[model samples]
Each structure stands twice: as C-alpha cells, then as structure tokens.
Target: MTQVQTLDRTGTDAVAKAWTHVRGNLRRSAGQRLFDQWLKPVVLVDGSTESAVRLGLPSSFMTQWVKNHYSERLLLEFRAVLPEVVSVTLETLSDEPQRVLKAEVEAPAMVPPPASAERPSFDPRFSFQRFVVDSTNRVAFNAAKAMAMPGVPQFSPLYLHAGTGQGKTHLMHAIGQTFLAANPGATAIYVTGERFMFEFVQALRSRDTHAFKTRLRSVDLLMIDDLQFIGGKDATQEEFFHTVNEFMSAGKRLVIAADRAPQALEGFEPRLAGRLGSGLVADIRPAELELRRAIVARKLEDMPAVDMPAEVVDLLAARITANVRELEGALNRLVAYANLSNETITVDFAVNTLGEVLRSAQRRITIDEIQRAVSSHFELKQLDLISERRAVAIARPRQIAMYLAKRLTTRSLPEIGRKFGGRDHSTVIHAVRRIEDLRAKDVEIDGAVRALMRTLEG
Candidate 1:
C-alpha cells in the first residue's frame, strides 16, 4: 500500500512537470498572438490521472476552438514529455460537466464519416429567430431565409460580405439550423476558412485527400466563414475552386462569407473570385444609429431584472458604434459587474464601470477629415470640393462631403457651411437631405457613403 501511494505521488509530479514543458512548447510553436488569444487560457484541471489529462477553458466556444485547432498537437506534446500520458480532453471550466472534446488516440484521420452519419450542429443561439433585421442587413437576412427554405436553391453560392463582428457568421449558422430543421435528414456543415485549411493540410500529409473531397462534396449545405484566412494558400485555393464548381453543378446550397467582396479578396485566384461572385452577392452595412439603439433596447428586454436607465441605454447605443459584438460586450460587462457588487444600474455606475471602453469609443471626426476622405474616394482634388464648380463630378462629391460631415461630426449646419467655401447653411441642409434620399434609392451612393464612414471612423 505504501509503494502504491509513493508511485501515485510520483506520477502527479511528473504530469505537473510535463504540463509546464508542454506550455512552453505550445507558446514557441503557435507564435505569440495565437497563444495569447486561444491557448493561454487553458488550465490543467484537477483530478487528472496518469493516462487521462483534462484541460479547461473559460467558455464552450473557446474550448471548441482549441479542440479543433490544437487538440492533437497538445496530446503529442504531453506524450513527448511523459510517455504515459495517453489523452488530452477539453471542457469548459464550469461546475457542471461539459461535453468532453476528446482528442483521438493518435492523430485524427482526416477522413470524415459516411454520409449517413449525423450532421454537424450549429449554435442554438444563432437561430433565425434571434437575428435582428434592419435596413442594413435585411437583404442578406431575407436571402439566408430563402435559401434555408425547402426546394431548389434560388442562388448557387450566396456570398455574404461585411466587416468583422458584423453578422456574417450568425446568418450562416441560422441558415444551417433552419435548413436542417426543415429537412431533418439533410446534411450540413459549417467550417471556418482556417479549419478547412487545417483539415485539408492534414489530409495531404496523411495521403487521404479523396476522403476529404468526398466529405465536403457529399454535404447538402456547406457554409464557410472568414474566407480571408485562407488567403495565399495556393493548394487550398485549388481545392476550394473545385469544391465551388461541384456545388454549382449539383445545385447544392453553398454559402461563403468574408470581410470584403469577392473582387477585393487579395491573393485569390481570379477564376475563383469570378465564380464566387457569379451568384447572389449581398453586403451587410454597418448598423446605423437607429438600428444600434434598437439593438440596445432588445438586449435590455432580455434582462428584465437589470433596471438599466434610459440614459445609460442611449449612452451605450450612441457611443459604442464600432460593432454589435463590442456594443453587446460593454453592456454585458456593466450588468455582470453591477450584479457582483450589488450596485444599482444607474448611468453614473455605468460610466464608472465602463470608463476605458467609453473612452475608446469616443472617436471625434472633424469636417476637414471628412472632406479629405470624400475627395480622395471620389478622385477629386481637395480644391474641387471647396470650388464653385457645379459639374456632376465635383458637385456630387461636395454634397457627399457635406453629408458625411453632418453625420460623422458634431458641427452645426452653419459651422459646416462656413468650412465648405463659405456656402450658406441652406446649401448644407439641401446636400444632407439630397444624400439621405439618394442613399435610400441609389446603391452606389450608399455603398460609397458606408465605405467613407468606415475609413474616416477608423
């Protein structure tokens, strides 16, 4: 009995020492940025045995991400340090036991299961019911819903483009979920660009490329998010081009999303870009002020217990205009800290708790900056904007500059007029009204304004 006790202690010490060595290996191999974001949070859970090791992450999402990307690497690292270490499992760091994401006994065979196997499940929170529609994303939302409905796809590859944290992934997940619900036996898969590349590389190393192709081609619906990550990967691009062709030929639903339009994707093959843009291409603009306010109110409605003041709501909606994720994160932080401290959810309390976030959110753009951005975008000289020329080329750009100045800056109408070659305040008003009306009817003008606003705000 004493011998067994000593052996157990020795094993525990060995595992602890092995974990330290493994962490160093991971940091050096994964690089600094990837390590800090995903791997740094992993902790060796208590009660791990010699043959079975447990790793914990803060959230299920992080756990899944780490599992998908680093699980095999982690297991190999542990075994190299301590040969007895047989497995490394990932789970959320909660009191309740999470679904254990088990690494394979060896490396995963890049081969996927048969077509009859269960389809991948999407996040329940990202259903169509949860998505909020507005003028900015209504077209994309409607297209997603239409694709998910039963019958033939109206468009082969529905392309969704937007900035980060904007609703691309959400809509993709919603489409997968709704489609699967409507067609219970249908198969669907959602993979990030990075994950697809990782799997493809693994298959190449294993000499099992056929299995990978079959797995993807057999799916009824395929949605790939963040296609920008696979940039410059020549082999992956070749495989992706073929995959796109297969989907189009089969009339299967193929959805892709990226930070920019297909034509704007750098290092991508021209043929691939042209094929991707051959179908319906929809862009989700940044949420306007009204939509942001509505989002805040919608979030508040979910938390009935938290008595957030109207002033606080307005403050959050108006200030945090970067993305919906950041906006919602600020609100969550305020609510969580207030709950922990048993403090009243007042405007003053919110201001104090979210000082750094609010400070970063306050980006004060000037009229001069707007004029320069607009002039540069329109290929007009700065002098042309302030000149008396009324040509369509010059006058239209000037009106756009005035409209942006009004929307992005806090200057009064008279102040804006004084800066624009001493025009009357009425001219500025007409420009604002005319641009506003044009945005509703003219896609090109709206796209230009959205692009200018994003550039100037940054």
Candidate 2:
C-alpha cells in the first residue's frame, strides 16, 4: 500500500506536467470555447508508474465526445510530451461505485455508440488563436472577434460566408468558444446544417417538438454552420427562423455561417434572407500564399521533432491552395507518415505523398485577381488603380500591379493593358519596365512588389 501510494504521488506530478502541456495544445488545437466545455473538467485518473496514461472526465458524454473527435490528436500530443507514454484513455469520474470500477476496468458504458453525433460539437481547435488571419480572412476574423465580446454583441446574428474549407466553420466555432470563455456558464450550442435538419426532423417525428424548440432556443449563444443547405427545408426553415428570432429578440448572441451570402442562398424565404443580412456580413476571401505558408507553419508547430524540410512546407503551402482544412490534412498526412516511419519529409516525399491533393488544388491567378491583390495590399480600391487618376497613391500602385500582372499571369501586354481600364499596350509595357527599374532602386516599392509576388505565387 505504501509503494502504491508513493508511485501514485510521483505519477501524479509527472502526469500533471504532461497534462498541462497537452491541455495548452488541446486548447489551441480545439478552441477555447470547446476546451472550456468538454476538456476543462478532465483530470488525470490513471497516474501510474506504467507507460499508459488515462484521463477522467465529469461525464460519459464528455468522455465519448473527446474520444471520437480528439482521441488520435490527444494521444499524439501525449506521446509528444511524454515519450514513455504509449496509450491514452478517457473515462468518466463520478461518485457511483460502478463508475470507479468502470474507470479501473474499461470505459463508461454511457459512451454514445454512434460514430458521429446527430448534433454539432464544438472543437477547441477552432478558436481564434488557431485561426491564421491575413488579408483574405482579416475582415471576417475581426468581425468574429468583435461579436465574441462580452455583453450584448454590438451586432446580432453575425453572418460569415466563404467558399468551402475557408474557415467559415472555424469562425463560427471560434465565436462560440470565445464568447463562452468571456461569459462562463453561458449556454452555447453549435449545430451544423445537416445535423440541425436531422435533429429537427427527429423532434417532429418523436413528438418532442416543444422540447427541441425549448432546448435550441434556450441557449445564450446559438451558432449554425453551413446555412446554405437550409434552403430546401421549408419546415426546418420555419423552426430555424423562429429560433433565430428568439435568440435575437432575447439579445442572445447568434452567428450563422454559409458558403454563400444570404441573398445568394437559393429558395431561402425572403424575410429570413433579409434577416440574415440585417447584421454584420463578413466574407472570407481565398487565402493568400503568405497566409497559407503561415497556416502550414502553425499546423506543423505540433510536430517539433519531425524534420520537416523548409522546401517541403513551402511546397505544401504553394500546392495546397484549396482551403485551410485540406491544407492541414495534407500537412498532417506528411507529418504522420514521417513521424511513424522515421523518414524525413523532403520536397520529393511531399510531392509523392500529396499528388492527388496538389492536382485538385491547382488554381491559376488572373490579371484581374492581380489587380485586386495589389489594390488590397495598397489599401486602395480596385477602381482606384484602373481609373485615370495620376496621383502617386494610384499611379504607382497601378504600375506595380501591372508589373505583377505581367509577371504572375500569362497575360499579353495588350490584354494586360485592356484589363487596367483599357490603356494601350505601350502604356502597359512602360508601366512594367518602369516598375522593374524601380524595384531595384526603391526599397519600399521593391518590398511591396516582392511581398505581392509571394502573396500571389505562394
């Protein structure tokens, strides 16, 4: 008994340090909102002299939720911090005599048997800290941060839209997580479009419509993702419409995200569509090359021991231009293979490992896009660069943008000139030539051009 007690004490300290490291990473990886909800209650239950580790949660529900979504990553983080550790387990901690036996034996029988939840779950990995912000996503990111502030949100029903994998879901999750952290005990629910539909249908079928409505509307924070799918569901829409009104009317924070803007959602009721746009509407543009590189760096921060070559990361950032999710997946695949097989991830290895992803992610930049990129960089409107204004702010940026268009896109000088408010081909040539000369001479312009090039190319 003495030896067992001593071992437990020693193991507790070791596990505490390990869990601290793991928790930080988990909070960063999962998102603050989710970590607070699901993981904040967890503590070490299996602190033994053996290599295996176990975690105890307050309920079987939390245990199973983390097990399904975070088991692999949790184990990875554990092993990363404690090389001696080989296994990680999660069990419910409760006063029941059976609960003690359950943690000591296998798991809580209460773990939901389903592979996926019918309801959306908050992931701690989706917090604002984990979100890689840049020119493309800055507006949306800022808007999300603002909405997450304490007290009634200055804006209600913040609407975020982006193409798939572009962090619409991330922001939605981030807002919920951040808002919850600021206001503890705040009831926040995250529901996906399909999951919300299924849950609503089940409620109607089970004759539990009142309970469902009460549960969904009672939350202080309600976040709905992928609002585009709510289009075809007339019944669901009616309920969801009321849910929105309930939240808004009560001054509860409500955030809705979709692939398209409210107006662009086909078949959406006119009133609902109008209501969606009544609040802040922030759009996440496609990620820039620099942003992708930064995201890749952020993703690989978890694998400090992995000898991920710079060229390989650059290759992934440059090639995997689809969205953040796919980019992270590609990085994860390469890192996992390298870590498991003890092989260094090189440029060649990355190329071979992610051929299919690269093919699908191939996106060519256009001259118009170049103009937009340059205009965005200079904080000037796209029209400012194209207009006949000869101010230094407009003309210099115009020339630099033309130079970028000539270099980045395969557009002819005449075509490029036509793009820049229909100037002659010689004007485009002079602009390109003059900018080329200035790039070497003017440090500011040179820096601007180089930064723009990296943004476009990467």
Candidate 3:
C-alpha cells in the first residue's frame, strides 16, 4: 500500500478500537434509553479523516444534540486513540445505505461543549432573570442566586428538592450559568444522577475509572439533578459519596436537585443523605394561584401577537396547578391550536383543549387546602375545625372538612385522621358517613356542604 493508504488504514484501525471502548462506556454512561435513542443511531462515516473524525447521526436534531452534549467527550476519546486527532464532529447521516462495519465512537464521558459567548450548557429560557419567583419558591430562588454569585459558597452541596416542573432543575441550571458568568472560565459540570451513575459504570467497564474521577473532580462546580434516581444504587452511591467528599474537601461548590428532601430520600445512603442536608436545603413548594396566574401571563407575553382572553388566562391559571412545566405546555398547546384555527381563545376553548390537564391539576390540591376551604366556608376558624371542640358550631364544619378531605384529597384514612387533631381512621369514616346522610336528609347542611365543595373545587 502507498504511504497515504497505509496512514488511512492505521487511522481506521485505531478508530475501530476506540469505537469499541467508547460505545461500551457511552452505553453505561448514558442510560440504555438515551444511548439507543441518540448515540446508538450514530454511524462512523466513510470520509472520516484521521485528524477530524466525523460521526453521522440519523437526523439533524440528533446530530445537533450529540454535537452539543457529547462532542467534547468524543474529541477527548479520539485524541486518546489517535494522538494527532484534533476535532470530533457529528453530522446527519444520508438516507442511502453505506458499508456497516464502522460502529465504534471515540467516546469519553461527556464534558459539556465549551460555552459560547452566550451561555451554552444552560437553556436560555431557564435563566434566573426569567424565573418567576413567588412565595412558594422564593427561598429556593434566593438560595440558588446566592450559590451562583461569586464569593464563598454560603452553602456547599446546596440541595433543592421539589416535585416535577416546580423549577428544581431550572434552579440548578441558573446556578451553573450564573456561576460561570460570575467566575469566568470556571469549570461547571451539570448532570443527572442517572447520567452520573451510567458514566461511572462505563468508566469501570472500560478501565477508564481514573479518567472519570479526574474529569469529575477537576471541575470547579458540579450540579447533579434528579438525584432520586440513584437512591438504592450502592456502587454508584459509593462513587458519588467519594466524589462529594473530594469536592467538598477541595472547597469546590456542589448543587444538587431531587424530587424529595434529604430525609425523604428513603433508600439513599443515610450518610450521603446527611451530607447533602449538611449544606443549605431549600424546598420549592407547589406554586400558589397568584403565582400560577403570573406565570400564565408571562408565558403569554412571550407571544405578544397572540390574543389570550382574560377568562382563558384565568382558566389556565386556576386549572393547571401541577407544575410550571405542564402549565407552560398547556398554554403552548392552546396558542398553537388557536393559531391553527385563526380564532379567538376562550375559556370554553381552553377547557376543551386541556380537559385532561385540568383534571390532572384538580388532583394537585392538598388535604390542608381542603380543610382550610371547609373551615372558611362555614365561617369558623381553621383551628376550631381541627381542635377537640364538640360544640355544633365547630363540629359541623369539622365533619365537613373530614368529608372533603376523604372525597377530594388522595390522603389515606389514617393520614387524613392525623391531620385533624389526631382523630382515628374510625372517626374519619364516621364523619364521612354522617356528612353523606346529612346531605340526603338536611337541606341546610346539604347546601352548606355543597357550597364548600364548589368553593374548594373551584
């Protein structure tokens, strides 16, 4: 073979070996679902040169995502295999068939692509400036801002936990972006708990464990979101604990997000949970009606031309309480539908378009809210309703609260009983039964209970 041909063959052989290791590592690093969906479809192209390797993905979207999220790691992996390698890029594969043996990828655990003049790792929409802060999430919002600001990290390993779409991940992203802006050139790594576990496992499989540790620890800031995924994962948790210790010891800041507070992370290592709680633990409560309304208005502001009726805005804000993400989605769907129809949006239109969302949102109400609503409707203090007062004035409202708590909220009998001044499950059952019979026989009691139900439901 000529020298050029010989060089090509050598490069091809190195890449082939690199691909085998990279693929295995990537499979472990990215979960099987992500690997199969995004990475697995990528094929090494025929025109791939030695210094600049090209990975061809199935679609433009996949190509862009891989380039954004995985290109840095791929470049590092390629350099390890071929010392002369300088760049790794992802391109959309052609529909026509090609020779199939090129399955390997130059793979390392993803180092997020270098940030552009504009933030790269974080979604522009998820910045602190755009986040709609209200009483529900103000503490978490402030804590996140503090973590992002330059200076001593007031709280290392700051843990922010909340239900889905309540902005926990958004806070992490904001912290990362702000941290980078405050301390330019500082390294920040943002990953999910599943991704962390996958990458650690991949490193172990590929015997690249040291590189994994170095890559993770070398970072100045590490943010892990959705940590509940690694709860019972022993080995992953072991590596995570060590990573946490090393970062804390070095005074590097860590930001973590989960679905529950540290104490509620039942299966997680107790020590790890305790360590997470050692830093600031901020809870983001479910957004209230006023906040939800404000979010709807802000979402509408994004499309200034779109006409969202006052009633429709009120409908969405009042109905969609599950999370800001879902709330946003419902609005998006409504606007898209409205534009398609070229008609005015109405409460009726919104109800029809988002009937399922409205139903789901209804289920978001808490037992506390139910109790408060019943107490308010009867013009009795909330404490009187839950206290041991046996007077008809308090007892009637108390029974109605218990009835609504059972009927509306998903709390169990025992749980609902505990909320009502330590009453037993039997008392809750009796209250529910008494209310049901009263609704049938007594007109005044029936009207009052029905009014309370309508008030709470609305």
Question: Which of the numbered candidates is closest to the native, going by highest lDDT?
Answer: 1
Better of 1 and 3 by TM-score: 1
Between candidates 1 and 2, the TM-score winner:
1
Q: On residues 112-203, what C-alpha lDDT tens digit does candidate 1 reach at each position?
A: 33554435545565778878889899999999999999999999899999998889988998998899889988988777899789878877
Global Cα lDDT for candidate 3: 0.77
- Per-candidate TM-scores read 0.63, 0.60, 0.62
Residue-wise C-alpha lDDT for candidate 3, range 123-233, written one tens digit per residue: 545789888998779999999998898877787888999999999988887887788878886777778888798878877887878867876777788889899999889
Arrange candidates by lDDT, descending: 1, 3, 2
Give the Cα-based TM-score of candidate 2 against the true structure: 0.60
Q: Choose 1 or 3, whichever is better by lDDT.
A: 1
Pairs clashing in candidate 1?
Answer: none
lDDT of 2 by residue, 1-458 (tens): 00111225544566556666666655543334445677767666644433787777777888888787667666767776677777888777765442221122112222322211122235667889999887788889999999888876888889999998999987887787787677775666676777688767867886878757766776677788888887889999998889888878888788899988999999899899998899889999877666888998887786677777765766777667778888989888888777777777786777677778876776677888888889899999999988999998899999998887765554678999998899999998899889979977898988898688767766
Task: Please give the TM-score that candidate 3 achieves against the real structure.
Answer: 0.62
The positional error of residue 208 in candidate 3, measured at the CA in angstroms, is 1.6
